[model samples]
Target chain A: MNESLRNIWTILKRELTGYFASPVAYVFIVIFLLLNGFFTFMLGGFFELGEASLSRPFFNWHPWLYLFLVPAAGMRLWAEERRVGTLELLLTMPVTAAQAIIGKFLACWAFLALALALTFPVVGSVYYLGHPDGGAIFAGYVGSLLLAGSYLAVTVATSAITRNQVISFILSVVICFFLILAGWEPVTSLMVRWAPAGLVELVTGFSVMPHFASFQRGVIDFRDLLFFASVIVFSLFGTSVILRGLRGA
Target chain B: MIDVENLIKEFGPKRAVNGVSFTIRRGEILGFLGPNGAGKSTTMRMITGFFPPTSGRVRIGGHDIAEEPIAAKKLIGYLPESAPCYSDMTVNGFLRFTAELRGMRGAQIDAAVAKVAGLCFLEGVLHQSVDTLSKGYRHRTCFAQSILHDPEVLVLDEPTDGLDPNQKHEVRQIIKRMGQTKAIIFSTHILEEVEACCSRAIIIDRGTVVANGTPAELKARAETAGSVHLRVRNVAAETLKSKLGSLPVAGRVSLQDNPDGSLSARVFPRDKSTRADLSLSVAQTATQSGWSFDELHTEEGRLDDVFRAITLPDSVKNRE
Candidate 1:
C-alpha cells in the first residue's frame, strides 16, 4: 500500500539521518576501508598475485571483512530502540511490523553501500595500474552488496532479540561466521561425510560464500541471485515475527 | 470516540489488565487515576494498538484495534510514559519524521511541525538534539510529536511526571485547551490534577477499577457521613460547649481553647448532611446563643484516603 511505503520511507529516512548525525557511520566507513585496503595490499599481496584484476585479493576477503564490520553497523538497528525505550513509540505508530523491518534494513544497506562506494579509489588504482575486466569488477561489487545485505539481515534479526548491543553484535558475528564457514571445502566435506547428503547440500547452498563466489566469477546466475534475495527476505521476515512476539509479550 | 470492552492482557501467568472497560465520548477529558503498576499504561497500550489484549476488544472510531490496527492507531496520538524519544535526532528532525510517518506531505509536514512546536513551546529547542535538552524540553518534544498527527483521540501517560510546578500548570492548560475538541485520556497519580482538569475519573488499584465517577461524586462518596468545624466568639466556653452538646445533629463535638476569645469546635453529624444545612443550623444556634460566629467551614473528604483504603493490600505486598 502507498501508506505502508510512506511509513517505511519515513523510518528509513530517520534511520539514515541517525547514522550520519553520529560519528558511528563515519567511523565504521573509515575502519571498513582501512581494513579492507590493508588486507588487499599488505596481507593478500596484490602484486604477488600478479593479476590485472582485483578478484584475487579484493573480492576474496569480503566475506571475512563483512563478518565483523556488518555486525558493528547493524547491531544498533533495533537494539538501540529497545535500550532507550523508543521501540514502544515506534510500534505504537500507524505502521506494520513488515514496514519497520524493511525500512530499517534498507537504511543499514544504504549505509553499507556508502561504505562500499568509498572504495572507488581502489577501483581506480587497479584500473590505472593494470588492465582488468570491467564486467568482473562490476560483478564483484554486486556480490559485495548482496553479501552485505545478507549479513545486515542476519544482524537485524539478532538485534531484535535483545537490548544489549554487545550481545547482539557477538551473536550476529557467530551466526554469520558459521554461514561463511559452511561454504568452504573443508567444512562442507566434513559435513558431507557425517550428515545426510541433502542436509549437507542444503547447508552449503545456504552459505554466503557460494552465492558470492558465483557473482565474483561474473556469472549472474538466477539461482545465486535468488539465494541472496531469499536470505534477505527470510531474515527480515523473521525479525518482524520476533518484534511482533515482543509486542504481544 | 473510543470504546474498550472487558479488555484483559496477560503476561505469561500474570494478568496486567483484568476485565477493564471504559468509553470516551467525543470531546471528553477522562482521567485514569491509579498508583504505579496499576495497569494504566497497559490499558493505554492496548487502546493504542501497541499491544494486543489477550481477550476483549478496543474500538476507536469504529475500527477494532486488534483487527484493524493501522486505522485505529491513525486516530490516536499517544505520549507514552517517561517521554521516550530518539536521542540522536534534533527536535525538528524528530517531529518532521513523525509528521512524515503520519503521511503529511511537503508544506503540510512543515506546517504541522510548526504548529505542534508552537503548541508545545518547543521552537527555541527545535535545533537542539533531544539528548541535549532538559527533561521538560524532552517532554515537550514528545508532546509535540503526539499532537502533530492531529489525532481524534489522545492518550498520555504521566505527561507531567518530571515537570516543575509552573511547567505542570502550563501543560495542564494545554491539555485543557486540547480537550475542548479531542477525546483525551491521561493517567496521573496526583489527585489534585484530576480535580483541576478531569471531567470524569476512573480509579484503578491492583488492575481493577475500584471507582469511576466525577470528582465531586467521588468526594461525596468518601464523605457519606459529613463533618463540620465551627469557631464561636463572644460566648463563654461553657455556654458554647453546652449549646453544642444539646444539638441532635452533632454526633461528636470536641472543643479546643483559642488564644483569642473564641472556641474551636469540631462537629460530626450522625447522618450525611449538606454543607448548606450545616451552615444554616450552626448560624441559627450562634444567634440564639448571642455568640458571634467567627468561622464556620465544612470539611470535604480527600481522594488520598480513598486511595489508601483501596491500595492497602498492594502496598503491603510491595513492602514485604
Candidate 2:
C-alpha cells in the first residue's frame, strides 16, 4: 500500500476496533436493531397494511433513526481528542489534517454500516411473509447507508467546532434537523407564503428526503448519489476549514 | 540540526513568543528555562510544527517549517507538555501506532518500538494501559513514542515535571545518553536540570531570550558570582564582617545562618569577580585572625539565583 494509504488504514482499523473495545459497538447495534423492528412492526402497521414491502415498515425509518445514532457515534470523534489534549499529539504526527479527518470519518461510517447490516433479519422476514423485491431491499440499504454518511459527516464537522461531546451532539442534531425539515411538506408549505419559488425549491433541493426517495422502489439515480456524495464532501471540507480556522487557539 | 529564526507567535493582541531566535547543533542538549507562561511550551509547539508561528521561520535540517512542514515534522520527535497519549491504548499499542506514523513498517516497526521501549524502560508496562500507569511511567511512555522513529531532533516539554527523584535521575541519564547524536531541546522550571544534562541553556522571559549560553556562563552572570561562604565557630559576625569588608579581595560580607548553630558569612569580591581568587584570601584571613573555622568555601553562584534574576528581573530589582 501507499504510505499515506497505510497510515489512514491504520487509523481506521484502530478507531473501528476502539469502538468494539468499549460497549459502544454492541450497544449501538442492539438499540438500532430493536428500534428498527419496533417501529417497522408496531408503528408502520406492516400487519394491517398487509404488504410484503419493507419500505414503509423498515427502510423508511432510516432518516429518523440516523438522526439520533449518527451524532451519538460522531460526538466524541473530535471533541474527546480536544478535551483530552490528544489532538495536539495526533496533529503533530506525519499525517496531514485531511488524512486524519478522512480516516476517522471512514471509521464511523464503517461502524454505522455494521449497525445497518445487522438489520438483515428484516429482509429475511419480509421475504418469508411475501416475495419482497430483492433489488429494492438492496437499494434501500444503499440509500440508507448514504443517508447515514451525510448525517455522520455533519456530526463529525460539528464535533470539530467544540470540545464538549454533549454540545457537539446537540449542535449536529439541530443542524441536521433543519436539513430534514427543509423538504418536509408542512414546513415548506408554511415557508411558501413569504419565500420566492426559486429559493424555496433550492432550499428543499438540499433536503435528504427528496434525494433519498428514489431508492425506495429500487430506482437508482445519479442525482441522488451525487447529493449524498456532495453532502459528504462539503461537510468534510467544512470540518477541515473549522480545524484550520482554530489553529493556535 | 535545529535552527529557529525570529520566531514570533501572537494570540489575539497578546504576543506569546516575540521574535526569539536560536540554533542547536547535533550533540547539543539545550535547556529552555523560564517562569510560568514564559512561552516555553508555545515555542516548542512551533518548533515541532504543532502550531504555526505568526511570523519568522523554523528550519529542521534545512527544511523550512512553513514551506515544508511534513519534511520538517518527519525529522522531529516531540513530547508535548503533560505527556499526552491515548490513554485507552496499551503502551505497546501506542508505541506501534507512533512508529507506523513515523513511517516505520513491517519488521522495522517492531524492532524500532522495542528499541525505544527498552531505552525508556517501558518494557515492564508494555501491556498496561497508558491511563493505568503512574506519572513516571506515563512520562517514559511518551518519551518512548517520541524516540520510536529515532528522529534527528527531539523536542520535549517538561518531560520530568511530576516524576519522583529517582525517576528524574533516570530520565536525565537517558537524555544525556541521547544528546550525543540527537539535537535535543527540553523546557523546565527546575534550574538544577540545566546543570544535570544541558550543554547549553537559554532563559526566556516575557517571550524574549534574556540569556543564552553554557550553563556555567549563566551561573557566572549572577551578581554574586565569586562570593565565598565562611562558617565560624566563635567569631562574632560583626568582627568577621569588618575584617573581610576591609580586605581588597572581598567586597561586602553578609551573614547567613548555617542551621547548625554556626555563624555563616558570605564574602563578595570587589569587581569582575567570576575568575577572581577570593577563597584564598578568605582562608588566609581566617587563619591570621585566629577564628575557629567550621567550614569555608567559594560559591559558584547558584543557577536558581541567576534564573530568578534573568526570568523575573522586575521582582529581583524591586527587592534590591
Q: For each candidate, what is the lDDT?
A: 0.87, 0.88
Work out the iRMS of candidate 2. 1.6
Which lDDT tens digits does candidate 2 get at residues A47-124? Answer: 788888988878778889889989999999999888888888888888888889999999999999989998888888
Which segments of model 2 are wrong by more than 4 Å? B236-238, B256-261, B273-275, B313-320
- Using lDDT, give the best candidate's number: 2
Compared with the true structure, what per-residue lDDT tens digits does model 1 show for residues B187-214? 9988899889988989887688889888
lDDT at B112, model 2: 89
Q: Residue A170 of candidate 1: its Cα lDDT?
A: 100
Expressed as tens digits, the lDDT of each residue in A1-249 for candidate 1 is 578888998999999989999998888999999998999999889878878787778988999999999999999999999999888889888888889989999999999999999999878988988998999999999989999999999999999999999999999999999889888778988888789998888888769888898888887888988989999999999998899898774
**Residues B128-163, model 2: lDDT tens digits:** 988899988988888888888888999999988888
Question: Model 1, B66: alpha-carbon shift in Å?
Answer: 1.1
Candidate 1 ranges beyond 4 A from true positions: A192-196, B223-225, B233-242, B254-263, B273-276, B314-320
Model 2 TM-score?
0.96
Over all chains combined, what TM-score does candidate 1 have? 0.94
DockQ of each: 0.78, 0.64
